[model samples]
Target: MVFFNLWSVLQWYLRPFIKWFLRKTTRLCELQRICYGDKPGAERSRNVEKSLMLSRTRDVKQVVSYLDNTVLERSFVPRNFPEILNPSVAIILRAKKINPKLHELFIVSFRRCLAQIWSYRLLLEEVEEMRKTHYDSSLPEHEEKLLKLWSLLVPNEDLESRVTKQWQYIGFQGDDPKTDFRGMGLLGLENLLFFASEYPQASSHVLSHSHHPKYGYTYAVVGINLTSMAYYLLKDGSAKTYMFNARQYLPNMNLFHKFYCYLFYEFDKMWIESKPENMMEFSIIFKKFENAIRNELADPASVFRINIEVDTI
Candidate 1:
């Protein structure tokens, strides 16, 4: 027994050798040294480098422009406010003027995007609560305090599960929200992952291709550039008031869509104005906007949209 124990200890001591050998085998050290500086920062820098590379792999120009034009630009729109531009009644009024099928798709996509954004707002609230918990301990209880504070630092596994499984199929038991969602009667996970992966190379690939059951949905922040810009502009602006006015018109607007429409309108207006009279300047603005959406606001669309089928259920 003693000999066996000693041998185990010796093997344990040599475990470091095994790790070093594996890292060497993987070319990790050389890769890290080349990708990051030679210091503790190497790991941190490597992680960030990987993250940035993943973020940039997408052709996100259009996405970013939409974000910037709607969310970031200062002069024209309400910052942080939802842009309500559905014009459903207007759409109905002009149904003959526009392609009904295209309009229907737009409405469906827009509503789904809005629902996803609503979830985002809840996410933001959780984030803010977490931030508050970190900075302020004035909450009534320690549990509440811990929850709010640590929320920002940690991922909300519970919330992730809730949103992911909200509209799951009747008998579906898979864990991943993206793959498990039975709505749209999607044909397995391949196409869905392909569609979303376009905006983020690494994440899109993982969400679309990863085989792990638990590693279901990638929480990609899809509309953040616009959201960030909207918040910035609406910071003490008239968007809140304007949105309230628009809401009077949308009795059927879900809370998610209500705020979303307001936000969308804000950006659409801002982008239209900022669109340069000259083609070159317009192109530059468009490019910057795309980067912001593709890189900065890496939101997952699978979780964002409201499942119309679920609304009735």
Candidate 2:
């Protein structure tokens, strides 16, 4: 009777944890299947494959095997934030030419507004903490600081109130990979930042050339390992480093222009650099690259796309 009673107690205590473990395992299996592509026998083999991969108990050798050399190189190279800001600066310059007032708007979006958004995010976190602690002491001080910051950043009281209210829902809680901004594609945070920092007259600047009225261009290049190389190069400074990393891609450069149009166009204004002296050389190189990829690159459907989760508030 005692043994049966102990077994019952153990089951009761472990039921919730067992249920959670099963749910987590199911989700992981689903993700793995998605990554491997839905082949006929893929699902059945995954569990066996997973067990084989994890069964290795070696210490140092296991770590060495998992180390990605390319990632290590990229980590060492420091990227200059200023280079990324160049596009935003160009947008401001173009806007200033059309409407001087809008140049300030771009600055506000890039600088002040972005800063205020972070500040509000921090305030929201503190407010949540205060709620958990059930203390009014932290509330007064936090409210005072938030009010001061809000007034300086947002002059309009109504707008400040509205922004604060909405911020509560959209608050970033933790380093949740699922909440990363990659999943939304065109409507993602990167686009939002570009949208905010870009001037109202961006369309006009992009459409300035009579022959092409498109607002943006995309560049898709192909090479044996251009994707792998470019991914790292983007993290580092000096355009020269990128050129070196992607040297092999140069031969097939033509593939880039053929597949992705953005390479030849300025992202903010979408100006085409097709003139012989300008970016024609780039186009030729990229077209050949595209052709090579089309011939050699296997089924692209099996390619793993980067996954970023969106946090909808």
Each prediction's Cα lDDT score?
0.32, 0.29
Residue 182 C-alpha lDDT in model 1: 30
Flag regions of model 1 displaced more than 4 Å: 1-97, 101-103, 118-122, 135-138, 143-313
The residue-level lDDT of candidate 1 at 183 comes to: 28
Worst 10 residues of 1 by lDDT: 298-307
Q: Write the per-residue lDDT of candidate 1 for residues 1-313, one digit (tens) a residue.
A: 9999999899767755764685568643322332333222213223323322333223223332344344233311222333432442233214223344544543443333332322333333432332233222233453243233223222333334423442222112433333332321111222223222222332223223222243222222222233334333233221222222232232121322333333333333334456444434534654565454334223211112222332232
| lDDT, model 1, position 85 | 29
lDDT of each residue in 180-266, candidate 2, tens digit only: 222322112222223112321332232233223331222111111222222222222111112222222311222111112222122
